[model samples]
Target: MTTEPCVAAPVRRGVAWHTPLSVAVLCAAVWLAHSHWPLLRGGAGRLAAADQGWLLLGATATLATWASAALAQQGAVPRRLPGARLVAAQFAASAANHVLPAGVGASAVNLRFLMRCGLPAARSASALAVKAAAAALVRVALIAVLAPACPGVVRLPGVSPTGAAVVAATAAGLVLLLCGPLRPRCRRALAAVGGDLRAVHARPGRAAALWGGSLAFAALHALVLVAVARSVELPLPPARVALLYVAASTAAALLPTPGGLGSLDAALVLALAAAGAPGATAASTVLGYRLLTVWLPLVPGLLVLGVLVRRRAL
Candidate 1:
């Protein structure tokens, strides 16, 4: 009885704290939108001048990403998931992704969904890691293949030997500093991920879905950017644009940003400029891309998330 009260008290307090925080965040968003309405209006006007067909194509690709994500999630585990619910969870996860840094929100939603589907917590986490690893590998592979076709599109900045050595030394020092405290936990996590990877790959069907879906997800994202560029009549070839998208995304992934918001926008703008887009054109292209991928689907995605929560599906 005493323990029950203690637990309930903390739960109540947590809810109390969260309610006010949520309201504060909502108010801040509204305030920012109102203050920045002119910028938003200008971006919208630019998008209005873009080719509608290409914009539609970008929107379609954005919608397809959620399905690809669900497929990859299923491929990470041997067990069959309820298909519709899985896709819905992915849609909800997208909205959640925009709220937390480094994909934490989406991962949490998927982890809970997997647990609801009966997997143990450790297994669920391992499956998520497998999916993430496959996505990273696919992104790198796409960049490698596409980058060569567009010569000089992505140039590595020349770094002096001294600078390189300093960076390497700093990385090594950081690793050594944390290694003692984190090594055991990291080892256990890696072992679990390795076990899951082996098991998932042993089944050819699962392996195909894992890699194929990851590829499709990355490709679709690139396609969204390409479509946006084309809509604005940007002079770059579609292939080159796709390559730039993949490369910029890969680099931006290093930053722990919410859905790669600021990091991705800046990287994409810089990449487009490097490819010869005028400043205004590059900014408009990015604005269009974000309109299709983030803002357009946000409200609906949040609704889906709420439904899933009410049904206890996540």
Candidate 2:
């Protein structure tokens, strides 16, 4: 008989037992933390399923923004990068990011994936930085354009107008500062991102395409937020939703909780409540929106996490 490898089979059993058990424990923790919700009554029960159009819109907007971001990167990447490949990588990365603790885990995985695609580690870092900066800039631009439209976003519960202004300023300042002061290579990296209009000087059309993609992303994403808000008949107008979506999103990202989890849910619920929704109704409405927005994406993301780990891609 051929000699067998000495790995213990019990190790596999141990792992299997631990993984699910840990997941169950974490899930139980989440449930307990969010258990403060009052039991939904009649109107609240209806709110849970009412006017789901905004959820759909939000989903579509989210999908569109991610696709556009990937496509834009492909257009400006150094090598003749394949758009489909990057998009797939992005999807895998997103899934990983959503389920994994802390957001950087996904970025690390994405950076590793890119490195495997033949980029040097240092260069990959630069590319990630550039991509992040561009996205932030675009987000800030959108808020400025849209924020004026929804000046009353200040009215949302727990929302301080001054806090909103500071957030917007910080986003703009940080991104612009990074883009301007990087080394020559970093500057080239941004150009390779198509943010360098000079390289495409002979073809301004590419630059136009980049701006167009960004604009489309902003519009569609704002529409989705407005729709999600409407699903519950929150007192906030669609214009307010459109304009303040970026700011609210930035604040959501700042939360320490993984995936912003219960914190985001609470923020949305409170915002709706401030918009004149009953507290219980707001809770159910927010919960329903999460079922559509968070859970829908999260399930596939967990599966993708397996692929990332198995491939050692992170």
The best candidate in terms of lDDT = 1
Query: Tens digits of per-residue lDDT for model 1 on 98-200?
Result: 7789899799989988887877789899999999999999988987898789999878889999999999999998798769888888889999999999888
* Candidate 2 lDDT score relative to the true structure: 0.57
TM-score of each: 0.87, 0.63
**Residue lDDT tens for model 2, 266-289:** 776666666566787566555654
Which numbered prediction scores highest in TM-score against the true structure?
1
lDDT to native, each model: 0.84, 0.57
